[model samples]
Target chain A: MKLYEYLAKEEFRKFGIPVPPGRVAASPEDAAAAAREVGRPVAIKSQVLAGGRGKAGGIRFADTPEAAEAEARALLGTELHGHAIDRLLVEEKLRIDRELYLGVTVDGAARTPLVITSVRGGVNIEEVPEKELVKRHVDPTWGLQPYACRQVVRRLGLGGPVGRQVADILGRLYQVFRSRDAELAEINPLVVSGDRVIAADARLNVDDEAAYRHKDLPRVEEGTELERRVREIGLSYVELDGDIAVMANGAGITMATLDIIQAYGGRPANFLDAGGGASVEPMAQAVEVLVSTRPKAILINIFGGITRCDDVANALVQVRQRVGIPMPLVVRLVGTNEAQGVEILRREGITAYRSMDEAAARVVELAKGAA
Target chain B: MAILVDEKTRVVVQGITGHQGAFHARQMLDYGTRVVAGVTPGKGGEEVHGVPVYETVEEAVEKHGANASAIFVPAPFARDAAFEAIDAGLRVVVIITEHIPVHDAMQVMAFGRSRGATIVGPNTFGVISPGKSKLGIMPNPIYRPGPVGIVARSGTLSYEIAANLSGAGLGQSTVVGMGGDRVVGLGFVDVLKQLERDEETRAVVLVGEIGGTAEEEAAEFIKGMTKPVVAYLAGKSAPPGKRMGHAGAIIERGRGTFESKVKALTAGGARVAGFPWEVPDLVREALGQAAG
Candidate 1:
């Protein structure tokens, strides 16, 4: 769950980290009002969950209230990097003496939280030379200490009051990261202006699995309608641009099904995991959701473990009877109760393939024939 | 002879009174695993599948002499369950719960490490030595005792490959699911090192998907191994920036790409299978090469 710039800044402010005066605007009129409130030249940033927004024309500057409204109007409903822009963060532009980067994210390889800071900021951290960056692993038990932050600051060749302020900000940002269950909390271009250091841009991505703990965070609607619908049904779904809709029992096998489809010269329209141990109703709902996409073909692959193949087959039969699938459907059943599942599907005028490779080939041919 | 669990290993099922825990406990018992006791916090003095349930891991360890724990606790309490087992001095703790908070997982992993214990997963199918003892949720019929050692990040994919290998007359000594979370205990390298030293494992098959540097790190370790390794990677057609089912299966910062993992593994002298079904043939060929 990626927070909008304004929301991240709000969190930053709560942690006592300085952020430029900003207001969230949902319309051109709101943008004009926000510009007037700011009382200076402002930056109108599209509140989309995407990086490199500045380079993608998702950020625009306005010198007047009318100009701010015009800039907001241009970006309000536009899609940047496939995310719909429904709101804008209108903030006063600041004078920058320098830009620095500060972030804390999980180090997957290390299995711990890592604090990253760099002298080079306002650019992609990946593009910056590795030598310029300073990184420290923070033990989750002990957390980020002030001494460690001071060391990172000194390593970046900063000293005096500004360095101390930067160190303090690092500690505060870490608190926000830990408290929010954020997978990533970053302030790119931590602007240094005269005597003060302020966060010019904020990015906060909360861990989706940790969402149960943070119910107060605003829910951002993401993905296609079908994607959202499947999510409601407790299935993981991702929309892709292809003709064949692929459904499988687990994440690994679902991804493998997509790969096998592409390997067999077919493109997958979506990736849907029915999940482990899915019973008949959610399985039926999953098929209904996939069929609603109306792809050139539908391929259902199940390597049932705790998920019985008979349950999957029953869902297929149920969906076929109720919804009446329009697309060419291919079914592959394996593992626990596979024989019973194949028998069930066979009785429904469907021949289930035992081999995934053969099933993938058949689905690709079916999709191509339909095309 | 296996890497993790075998006939000598005594097992305790955590969250034993729950649906998954009870069901898999019966399955493990049926597979000839020494499931001596269960722990359900408040459900002590009860019997699940003829196995006695205790209130805590300490009682289970003390009464049954259980050395290993299979956790089926809910995600919210998985950390406490792991901590309990680790504190009880259990040598092996396999957490079968999914959707556990990353912070909880990190803490449990650190605590497990400090206690000199091996924590398999916070979201895994558990470990199995096939025909010896099984501690996971994998179906019993697909596996058998043999020379190949399998380790994977994905459970279903590992089952698919193991079934195919068994069909091709290449049975496994053990199959380890390293879990699909971004932060998990017992990564590819840890399991690989164990398999490399196991006498029963003549060859190893690595089932990897896009995400993290675990596979890359395993590739570095694979360079020094004497036993043959076959690698099969999934998510070849997955789009960037979108997580593919697993929380860990996303490409970020131009890293953890399928191409990169394949390159690293190939350069480390491991045979990379083009598809999951192709894994058996590659394993056979590698085994043949090692024999010749």
Candidate 2:
């Protein structure tokens, strides 16, 4: 999960990493107070999960507390990437000597832990000259050796205090990256001031699957009220755009269903995976959640293995009856007495297709009519 | 003779007494898999499904001499359970639970590889060597033993494809659900290579879902195979988004695209099935060409 810069800074401070002094302000008055507390020449950064906040005028500089308050007023409550910026972070702006990049992540292919450090920072790492970026992969079994850090430092052409500080920080950061189960821990613009090096920006992406184990990291953002309610019912539901809602049993098959919809030029409104043993209530709830979209149509794709097709059909019938079906629904039922399930759907005036592509085409037709 | 499993392969259910472990344990036993032991963390000394349930995998291995293990532990403890089985010297570990963290899957996979153990799906239906051993939660009604070897990403899709192939009178020697996770222990290439080297398997069907280079890599491997290979790729219509099932399916800003994978497989010589129903015919044609 992507943590906002301010939140990442909070984590960095906790880890003994030096950061510019900052206070989060939720309002104009709060901004003035934070500015006064930090003394003048501060930066008010819009706090949002999405990137490009700075370019969007979400960040501004203020030499006075009044200017800081005015900057905060401009940033707070402004919409960026679908998130309301209720706050702005006011921090004392530092006189920079140089900015460098350092990060650690798991190598996607080799599946080995890797630590990356680059001399270029304070800008998009992708835009930086690739040859200048110093990268070293550490053997996790052997641990992050000093030589590995020196390799990055030497390539950067820094020596003495700066090199020592970077080498030490790199070692500690790699250790934290493993212990914390972080997918990404990037210190962009690790500012150097004589003998001291401080992190100016912390961009960390923690592994979502490992979220359950970490109590220290930010709690899973219960993004919306509807999502929280759906999670309570033992079915996985995520909201989306489009006019057709899809409810299915497995993730892979659900993905295939979504793909088929796109292939057929149909838009899927959401992904609802009911897992293996889905019954009437979860099914009904899933339908209700999708129906909240009041979608033009619903695509029910259940490829049962352990899950019975007849059981899913039974749930569909109950859900349609209970909810008083409004949208046009197209379903693809296969595996585990799929014939009997199709028979049941046929009896209920629901058209069931054996083919995914055909089913998607039918749903697209239904959706267009509704649209 | 089928690969990995056959009628005589004795099995033990690690994490038996749990919901899926208990359920599939009975199913496998009914399918004629000699389920000799059950391993629960502390529920040893109990009998589940007429099989002796042991506390640890070691005890089960020591007593029952079970060479194969099917894991149904919850996701958080799945890696540990897999490690236990492999450390206890089980030759094969079939993990049924899904959604274990990627790093953990990588670690357990590395550990299993070091111990010379073959690990199947961490999120999968496991392997079924029909009329022999059934070590997973796949509905057993669809399988039969023949010359066709099936390896796939989606478990139910594999079943559907296998059923279609079998109905066409081209039964499978073994069908393996390689797990859909990004960092799964075994890849399509790993399984396809084994099937090619196996004497009994005459032809192979690889059922791949889009989003990883594994399928493309398998296509390259298939180019070297003496036996014919029919490849079927799922999710041809999937829109780019957060993975709905396996974490591996997501397309970042650049790389491992559906279009690229399809092109790669086509460049290799394996006949690619455009959809699920086409698997049987494609396999048939590939086999025919091999014979000619």
Candidate 3:
């Protein structure tokens, strides 16, 4: 649910937050044409969903249309840090005296939305000194106050008309962030050129849950190969890499399976939430998808409520009988007709653990012992 | 003896005519929960499974003396329903719906907290005292009341923890699912505080996942507690750079990672059960230490 820089900038404009003239181009020729139209000295940035693109040569500065074309040609098809760059955004580079960082995101600790502003910009916020980051949370109930915005501007040492402009933009961004159900709305390297303030880079990630309400958004990542494979088997599959693959019922247990793998000093290869109502057919497919990794070990953690452990156990048995996956498994079954599941798994020489702590610890030991 | 809800707790169901609401309400009543009223907007004057329905939570609370409400409305209307419950003077509310808009949840949660109401979830299975009362959709068949106070963000994870404890001849005092959404009314620390004060709870079995600072907050709370806690965090290292499942279980660049929560819990002197199966034993060990 991450918007490209161009789309994010469009949102910035909606809030009256200024962004330099820019257009996204699908090709080097298009980028070159855009540079000619925007008139020279453009920044050709790779339109990838990740950051640190500049360090990876996915971003380049070009002073002429020809140079912009050259940079776009070099970057448009090249894979930067594992993501293949298919487009480039040619932006008129803002000449700034100073850069500042401003952003708003949901605070996990306070379970509240926070507005963060700082003089520190043009670098990863994580890299900045924690003490220097002037951060304040906006109680969504209470809209961002001019006083609070001014305090941030004053503390960050931003002065003149630019400071008030930044405050206005921040308020608007927060409004947009809230209205759009965005997980984060960030304007990095917010630049000051004379009296003009422009957003050098815009990043907006819409919350996936909230995306259901945003009907205008194009369905991004349409049934990717991994997603398609899961859908074919009617399984919930999220790809990751490690030797251990997890198959669990419900989001909580799937997460717990992952946590257990980590706690046992193991890395989980995937998180497949078979969900609360999954049956044997879906469970078998889920196991098939999980085993497709050919993991070193597979952990099936089921805290069945609507989903019975027996059905999960039966599904695992069917998977073993039919597909014969590569990994050995550890089973932790609990709740909602668990006895039948235990009976099935035990018949297959699998013993269900009594507790998640025990199951997780054992899998760690088993995976280690196997290693 | 229970932490949140029991037979004495008066309950109302928002969205009572809906499938999830009607279904779980029956189950809660089966578990001995005193569900007195139901709210389904236009469905007032009707009864959902013998529970009288009203048009508003205010009417339901006024009519039934309902002070606690469980919501089954969809994510979009969950915010309004929660506010209505709070407005009706329900002191404790449980929102089982998931994927609520963060802004909506923020307003509802913040407003509810300000009103001195404890909101259990916006994406959780709700809470249960097990054998005494169940406020959520947790299948009533598997649970039995005992001494373990369970608090987890994931529904099935809590049931698994309870099942394991039950298998080891231990029953739960109460198990609370704080919800898996990014923003929830309750937290691990909030549940832990109640568990800490509940005398029937002799020991606590805590289940946590990666992402968010909730586990870290709970770890900090645990450092101040005198009760025995057997803690298990979901999402270990999880491949060096994986997005932890559930919106809240994120690694986020380099903060609130699973490793950090585990480290914080271990540093705070809570028994870190390496996985699900080891939790009962870890609890037994911690309880033994407390007794010693």
Candidate 4:
């Protein structure tokens, strides 16, 4: 889960990391008030989960409170990269002698936490030359030792007092990264002043699976209202840009379903997992959620192991009776209780295929016909 | 002749009193797996499906002589449960729990490796040796004893492929679900290595997805093996950066792609199947060539 800049900075402050003081503003009036509180030139950064906000004109610098208010007024309620700018971070602007990048993240391949620092900063790290970036893997058992920080600092060609300060910041950042169960904790541009280094921006991606440990973190509001509503019903739903709504039981099967759909020349409208071991109620809710997308057709694929195909079939029949599906529905049910599942679907005047290939082809044809 | 667990391998269940643990425990026992003991912290004096339960894995190992453990502990406590089993001197630990934190998985994996223990998964269906012994959540009726060894990441996909293979007169020696998480303990390489050494497994089927370099790494290892391998990789048409349910099933920064995986495996002399259903024919053809 990605946190807003203000929230991430708040976490950074709690860890004793130096960050430009900031307040979150939800409206133009609040933006002016926050700018007045800071009593200096401020940067009004639009708060949205998506990236490239600056290039999209979601960020602006204001020399005065009125300017800040105007900038906020222009961005508020506007959509950037399909995400609304509902809030803004008003932070004190600082004079920077140089911009340096530093962060800590889990290297998925190595299965180790990595500390990354670079002399080239204030730009996308991917665009920077590989030679300019200094990276070191921190052993999960031993953690980020002081020597590890010094190595990153010295490689970037920093020395004396400023290098020590940056090294200290790097150490503390690693602490926050580990303790918070963060997938990524980065300060894109750690501005270097005369003798001080401060974080100009914070980008934190917390591990959603580790959310149980931290109750203090705010809940991430994702996707559209319909998508959110479906999530509230306890189904994992992701909206996509297509015309066929695809639903499956397991993660691997769901992806395979999506792949086969696209392979047969059909686009998927959404990715919905009924979850492993889901019964009639959750399965019914899943169908209801899939209908909310209003796709031209629906593909319900279940390779039941612990999850029973009969349960899924029963739920589909229930939804067909109560809600009355308007779109063409294609289903493939296999594994445990599959015979009963197929019989139930057939009795309901719905065609259920035992082969995923047949179901996928039928759905794609239906989708194209509907289109 | 199976790679890991067989009829002689005494199995212990960790978190045996839990819903999933108890359910799968009964399934394993019914399938003729020698489930000698179960471990649940405070349910020491209890029994799950007539198998004796112990507080610690050490006690289970000491009292029952169990060499393999199938872990059904919840995600939060899965690491500790695995650690206990490893520290207790179990050689093979099969973890069926999902959503274990990556850091915890890393620690347990490192600890397991150091002790020469093979940790299967942090999010898997466990391992199954058809008709002889089963140590996973797979539906038992779908399997039969044959010369093919299967190693896969996705649980349901593997089941689908296994059933298809069974229908085509090809059964499995053992099928291992390597889990679908980003950071899993054992990879395709480790399991493939085991299958290569097993005399019962004449040919191998690798079910992979577009994630991590596990498939690529397996391809590198396959170059050294004499056994024929047939591969089927999922998520061919999946969009980049969109996680297709599995955490590891995504294409990012130009790596872990379906094309790359297929290229690597094909270059390593494995016949890569276009779809899961095609695997059976590929396996048959690969085996026939060897016999010829």
Interface C-alpha root-mean-square deviation of candidate 1: 0.8
Ranking by lDDT: 1, 4, 3, 2
Residue range B1-292, candidate 2, lDDT tens digits? 7888878777889888998889889899889999999999889799998999988989888888899999999999988998898899988899988878766876777788779998887888888888788888888878878889998888766776777777788877888988877777777877887898888799988877767578778878877888887877766555565554566766654456777777887787777776677878887787788788
**C-alpha lDDT of all candidate models, in order:** 0.93, 0.80, 0.82, 0.88
TM-score of 3: 0.91
Better of 2 and 4 by DockQ: 4
Over B136-183, each residue of candidate 3 has an lDDT whose tens digit, in order, gives 888776567788899887877777677778878888899898888888
Per-residue alpha-carbon lDDT of candidate 1 for residues A1-371, written as tens digits (9 for 90 to 100): 88888999999999999999979999999999999999999999998878889999999999999999999999988899998899999999989999999999999889999999999999999999989999999889889999999999999999998999999999999999999999999999999999999999999988888898989888766676888899999999999999999889888889999999998889999999998998999989988988888999999999999999999999988898898998899999988898999999889889999999999999999999998
Q: Write the per-residue lDDT of candidate 2 for residues A1-371, one digit (tens) a residue.
A: 77777887887777777888987889999898999999869988887776677777787999999998888887787788788888688898867899999999876455567677788878877677768788776555566787888777888898998888888788777766766677788898899966679887777777878878777777646356766677778676666677789987766667666766776788888777777767666777777777777889988887777778888788888877777778788888888788888888889998787766688889988898887
Off by over 4 Å in 2: A126-143, A155-157, A220-232, A237-240, A337-347, B236-241
Residue B107 Cα positional deviation in candidate 3, in Å, after optimal superposition: 0.9
Indicate the TM-score of model 2: 0.92
Please list the residue runs of candidate 1 whose C-alpha ends up more than 4 Å from where it truly belongs after superposition: none
Top-TM-score candidate index: 1
Which residue runs of candidate 4 sit more than 4 Å off their true CA positions?
A: none
Candidate 3 chain B TM?
0.97
Q: Candidate 1, clashing residue pairs?
A: none
